[model samples]
Target: MSIVVIGSLNMDMVVRTKRAPEAGETLFGQEFALSPGGKGANQAVAAARLGAEVTMIGRVGKDSFGSGLLEVMKQEQVHTGYISQSESQSTGVASIVLDEEGENRIIVVPGANVEMKPADIEALESVIRQAGIVVMQLETDLNMVEAAAAIASRHGIPVILNPAPAQPLGDELLHQVTYLTPNETEAGILAGIPVESVDDAERAARILLQKGVQHIIVTLGSKGALIVNASGSLHVPGFPVQAVDTVAAGDSFNGALAWQLTRGKTLDEAVRFANAVGALAVGKAGAIPSLPRLQEVKQFLQEAAEAEPGAQ
Candidate 1:
């Protein structure tokens, strides 16, 4: 089985500082680093590392960043045949500021990412049709996302939509998504309810169910995720870990969830696996660099299980 990711690719420029800059105040940072990241690319890398055959469909510039991004994908064994180069734009870039606590504030320049259009999805119809699951995010054009979802819907392929960056989507898009994964903030935006607690998350998820989304997974950071469907709801507690950077935690969860589901795991099982992935990701730093491989995640899960009482 294969997973197709249709979204953005960016070179992330990260700076470590004591805290975010004030409105007009500028402070010097402690460290600077560049890494391959973007919602789409990070998720693809996360899935690929977990043994998923992932094909990336997106656009990048003809610049060095684009070249490096493609090379990173290739090195990770993610298929990049569908990734194109934009002639008139630079590769997308994310300016990330990380505070002492590993919290981040990011500003993105869409650049070539904005060039990905609905036509791009049409041109790759065959690729999408051949995938076991199609994954997408809000980092790209909404129309393109909807187009991809529509294609997957017509072919009866399951579509996983990660509603990141918290944008308001229409019912047309929601109806096509087989699974919708959103953090608490995003769930609040989409469901029109404040997601402050587990009950709040469930209420918000119920609202999304009313909007036609088949399944809703509300990621609650340290609280783990709330999985809701017509059957009922399950709260998968998070794996406790000392987090260093949370940049790729959500992406790791999404990728692992898709991989586990494609392997025929139940929603509850998949979310539990995803929670382990997320915990491992936050223990490290950077985006793609932080995503744990299959062995690491498995070991972490095994250790956690054995650490419990009454083990064999």
Candidate 2:
């Protein structure tokens, strides 16, 4: 029951400023930090920390960032067999700015992430086939995402798509997806509806399901996530936590959901765990450094349980 993530791996430069900059404006930053991040890497780390056998498939440049990024994956116990280094392109990068309110504005340079070709997926066919869940984001080449989905479909592996930085994809692509998890903005774009509330989320999710996605999970940040299926919908509200940075909160949710599914938990149960994990993530700073381990999650659940009024 391994989880495979096929997406981008990037070096992130995060800055904290008074507020997010406008289209052509610059502001003085209070602090700056370099971190290992990328939608792919963040999800992989999130899953690995939650006790899943995780494998990461992506590319990095043949530079220092590449070396360090590989080490980071190893440290997290994520299988790096499918990660490669390319000298032709530098590592992908994300320039992120967090305002005083913890809102972020980001710009991504695809770099080596864009260089990942379908052939890369083709070469990892064996690994892809062994996955119980294949998770993906839109940071890498969409062709590669499609190739992985195609292979996963052949093996009966469930494919989970998190269409972040939302882009247009096909019903063909949607048909191959076993689970489609998107934030409100992404759901709005994919379902062509104004997704401003839970009612809108249900409407949007139903539209995607009609397009052939087996399940739809629309993440609503502080509002938690809405899970929709043929049976109906359920809303799992977020845990109360003081948010310091919200960079990888969605990735953490996706990763935790995949881990729970691989462990044979129902989608409803998975969303509960994912909600807790995501709430914990935003309570800290930096993507990699903020991920909670399995033990930490266990402890959190225990504490929450003890705090409940209905006791022995």
Off by over 4 Å in 1: none
Best by TM-score: 1
**Alpha-carbon local distance difference test for all models:** 0.93, 0.91
Candidate 1 residue pairs in clash (backbone atoms < 3 Å) = none
lDDT of 2 by residue, 1-312 (tens): 899999889899999998887789977899999999999999999999988999999999999988999999999999998898897999999999988777788899989998988887898999989888999999999998988899999999999999987998989889999999999999999999898889999999999999999999999888888999898999987777778999999999999999999999999889989988998899888988889988888888778778778954
| TM-score of each model, in listed order | 0.98, 0.97
Sliding window of 10 residues with minimal summed lDDT for model 1: 239-248
Candidate 2 backbone collisions, by pair: none
Write down the lDDT that model 1 would get. 0.93
State the lDDT of candidate 1 residue by residue for 1-312, as single tens digits: 999989889999999999999999999999999989999999999999999999999999999999999999999999999999999999999999988887899999989998888988888889999999998998898999999999999999999999988899999999999999999999999998788889999999999999999999999888899999999999999988887888888999999998998999999999999999999999998999999999999999999999888988
